[model samples]
Target: MAKADNIFNIRGRLGDFIFCQRNGKTYVKRYSGGFTKAATQNHPNIKVGQERFAQVSRYVKSLKQQLQPYLWRQKDGTFHNQLMATFLQIAKNETEKTFNELIHELDSYSSLSNKSLNKNSKIDPSTLLYDAKTNKLNLGIIPYELAVKYKGLFLEVATGWYGVNDGEIFLTESNRQYVKLDGQTKNEDQLVDFAPADDLDGQLPFVGLAVVYTDDATSESPHPVHTVMACFVETRNG
Candidate 1:
């Protein structure tokens, strides 16, 4: 026996019904045979008008209760159920919105309520990084943007997984890769013949713009921390 989701019981009968507005009058009728016809005239039900929606308040209250425990894992990130976490957060955070409106933005599920569905349901937005008009990354234009944005900042133009020569001002292709030994690929920035100044941090300009994507652990740091990513590779072009 499957559960009846939206069915209503009227006059001791297990059937389906809907409330509708006709002209200026509101009435209730069976899901079928009640659209243009009335319960007394069309589907021959025992009741008519407004009473069809009597159970609606109870159903709405039940739905509210069912959603109470939604995404308990979201506020506490100890658990890893992605679906429940996302839906619960979305439902709770968007106070001005309703679940019905919020659900349209979600991918649908069946047989299981999404409230308890535990699956890897995440979307990465990397594709959205492209230029909307050209549908490409305009890498050529980024150099100027970098110079402007990082004009006053002290930046390590070169980053290394193995090691970096402290206070170096040059770079080379071999600098892109890393090695376990010190001074092997560690001295990448020495390849440049940068003009020396009294103060390298203030007088020297940054080599170019880059989009370094370090892990969030470094977010509190004034600059990026360990395990820097591929954006440094493009900085060489600047």
Candidate 2:
């Protein structure tokens, strides 16, 4: 089956059809059908493609599982599917690209990049500072525009390791800190820290951030109206 151009402006496999985009146009195509198992196995190229697809799928699944805490609140189900497709394309077209190089490429990419944490959030992630030595993330003063409306803020920091070759990922540590948007807390800087073991070998380290705002400070299941999340640093890549 041929790749689709995402005519529906969607991605992933829907039943037998797969949706995708190429250039600026969107198209849809059947990803599966009209192929016997024995016939497919007879073609070496098809077998190789199938193996590659399976490997990509496994790697992407592990990646998504590791990032679930940051992305579970996301409503869009297609995010990971699109992400898988992007990784497949990279694997097929750029075999020489290292995982670090791929990370760098994704840093500048649109549509599937981690840069778009939350569109509704007033806070700009670029404005937040990361201190390498102290392992502290400083979320500078929340602006007056956001401070007046939402009184509760949640900050999360997570660090992990990813093995590109094996598609294995480990969540080393996570820190969750809360702040009340009152006169004292909102006026001062907020900080969160993460400390993971230094013994993780043969894997790249990644640190991620999540910031959410809610109206009820004490609500156990506060519905976050504004959410911000991103992986700011990959120690190996940086």
Candidate 3:
């Protein structure tokens, strides 16, 4: 007997058309008519052919409804369920804390006067001095997350050095580039500042505080590079 064709090539149509393969021979069953078996006697391995048919039938049943319109535009219910499941999993692992709770412990320290320099002082004297100079005091430590959420309030208080433009809060051109204020190009430095404008709402312009650091050197050389911290001292606008 001649060898049969592979069963993989047999295709099925929608509605009531049935397709099957035995050995290498193809067969079909139509809804309106009787079944038609292959003429060739070349039979495929019965076990493998039955398994292949079952697998294909399972795949076809799993497919979406054929007559549906714009399949891609429709929300996949299965996919949405999967996404929600993943979100719940993430929420379970995360720690939930209120902004006030996170920074409340630092409130006492943040309100202290910057003068009378003492280890027991609740606040840094320099910060108090700056507040006095600017006529503004650090209310408290803003939770990092809350600060980001209410960034508009902070931006209102910031100087023009920071502002939201084109959907991002960025430093102005004057402060855009990192400066080696301490004269160490190899080290890193950044400056940011912000203060409220004259408007009654007290919106702040973006300002950056400058950061300065020295690079680690291979030799134990005393590179006494220090950025003048005084530059950060707040000044009242005329």
Candidate 4:
């Protein structure tokens, strides 16, 4: 069905039709009927009035479209996140904390790319060994999984549209390209010789780690002063 375009401004509703005002004239009519003069009599029955108001509320809400909000923070100390801090009323100075920490908590970090590596040579998944030699933090072999659900979309790798021949998997919808595993063919028999492993950026297929330090920003730090705040296999891309 095609959507109707009407210039009448909806004010409320009557029994079987909506109350609206056109160019300097008040009228009432259901969406499919012709406009007529609005009824001025008050609904004497309170129960009937409540039901009518409820119907009008649902109809009016259906016409609106909402947009998603994008939230982000700039630096550690600066209060640059106006979208959530002021508009959403989620941010308030109740505690003395840094802005960097606040935004990470609010926006929820997103991951980009992930890869599987040698499992035999991986470090402990629950431990973050700070390499004094390298001065960097690194993680090892992490397990991951990917689940795809298609309700009603005609899609398959190495196939084309109906009654057509295209020997490629179309890269649409988020450009999510799937690479065939080693020595695996594209469309032969649709049998599973091997499956591609999904990336583990921040989708949280498993728990991750968080670390904090109380250093004085000095060159030489003391022992036990370097304590682990949090430890897991999480890594953020963004």
Candidate 5:
């Protein structure tokens, strides 16, 4: 049994300030007010303590609107354009490393294959590295675009073509296993190959960029208690 004051504290901290019914059609109290009474009622559905609930709801809605602009400035928002630019620069560096490794491996394999001829052959490691690097660089672009488009959704980017949907990106698993949504299973990798691209021109998916909370328990000194973790993803669609 929580007091009215305790309830107010919970609402102020959690942002929502109130709970709703299972169907989302009815409102509940901010604290323990009338909770036991409402539960005992024979009515299958009931809204308890409407006045307080409305106050909290309105406050939360307004707060969201007020914070919208700042939220959009995060990397998961309009600033994604800048993040993508930076990602390209980093990817270029990684591609070079991958190219060098592949060249060395291929050279060793080629040398063994030509051992019977008893002749040394120049395999042009530079050309092979260039070709592989180009292919990976192109492939890398798709994930970057997808990350920008989807923002915060959980996207699994495996090899080969994939698709983007409402808020999900469909792709094959690294082990060639079936795809799974939040819980339900779907078609295997084949469906991902033919999935449709998300219409980027329409409403862009905007999920929470980061959740910041105070680490009050671990604080050694009086410092800003908030910490944030940004969510990012890679999708098959560019």
Candidate 6:
């Protein structure tokens, strides 16, 4: 590095040299172009960092895509970065835990619990129950207040499953079920069901919920959509 005596007083990168002012005096130095892929891949420390980053990115991308339908309107921009950092920490430090374990623990360890489709809505969201024996996920009843609030409109409830072993999502048309929300009823007792294929056996299951009002609803209000992460189940084998 050397003092910059040029009249231009350049304060940015110019070719291989970088000019900047420090302590009211301009200085110039050779710009570091950063490490090459070969250099980073060969370096022991950098290589480990690279591997961890790749693993984290792969898992994060898959999960975000699976949850995008429900989280499209979320305003928090840093959630993804926060989740990535969390996963990266696990990837680097928790060598014994499998990738599926990370997915299973997402609701507790990551920012998933904070995400909601309709934050200001008055209606309460339904809960979920998973059955390991039947490979089915059950959606609990939606309160009658939801029906009265929505003017007797049906609730469109959908379930999604994420298989960490294959990095695939198993949400299909057959997985969607509608629950009638008649204002007269005390509660909607019909249990919504989602069944995953047998091929998903022995894979980690991460389930989520997406609920919205039908288009024909006569309610004049905010029409809340409830999207939630139900549970992450252990890898089960038949």
**Is candidate 1 or 6 superior in TM-score?**
6
The worst-scoring run of ten residues by lDDT in candidate 6 lies at: 216-225
Poorest 10 consecutive residues of model 1 by lDDT?
Answer: 121-130
lDDT tens readout by residue for model 4, 105-165:
4132222112111112121344222222332233321111001111121111111011101
The list of candidate 5 runs beyond 4 A from truth reads 1-85, 91-207, 212-226, 236-238
Predictions in order: lDDT: 0.28, 0.51, 0.28, 0.24, 0.26, 0.52
Instruction: Give per-residue lDDT, candidate 2, residue 131.
Output: 52
lDDT of 2 by residue, 26-118 (tens): 567877666678987879778667767777777677767766654455444455676676777767666565443554443323233233333
TM-score of each: 0.18, 0.51, 0.19, 0.18, 0.15, 0.49
Ranking by lDDT: 6, 2, 3, 1, 5, 4
State residue 228's C-alpha deviation in candidate 5, in Å. 2.3
lDDT of 2 at 74: 47
Candidate 4: segments with Cα more than 4 A from true spot:
1-11, 31-238
Candidate 3, 1-238: lDDT as tens digits: 2222554555555467656666557666665654345522234554444444443343223322220210112233353343234323332333263222222222322222222211221222242112323434331232222233322222111223222233332333322222222222222222233243343122222221212232211111121111111111233343
Give the alpha carbon lDDT tens digit for every residue of 29-88 in model 5.
544344466466544433332332343344334423433322322223323333333333
User: Residue-pair clashes per candidate, as listed?
Assistant: 2, 8, 33, 1, 0, 0
Model 4 poorest 10 in a row by lDDT: 65-74
Candidate No. with top TM-score? 2
- CA lDDT for candidate 6: 0.52
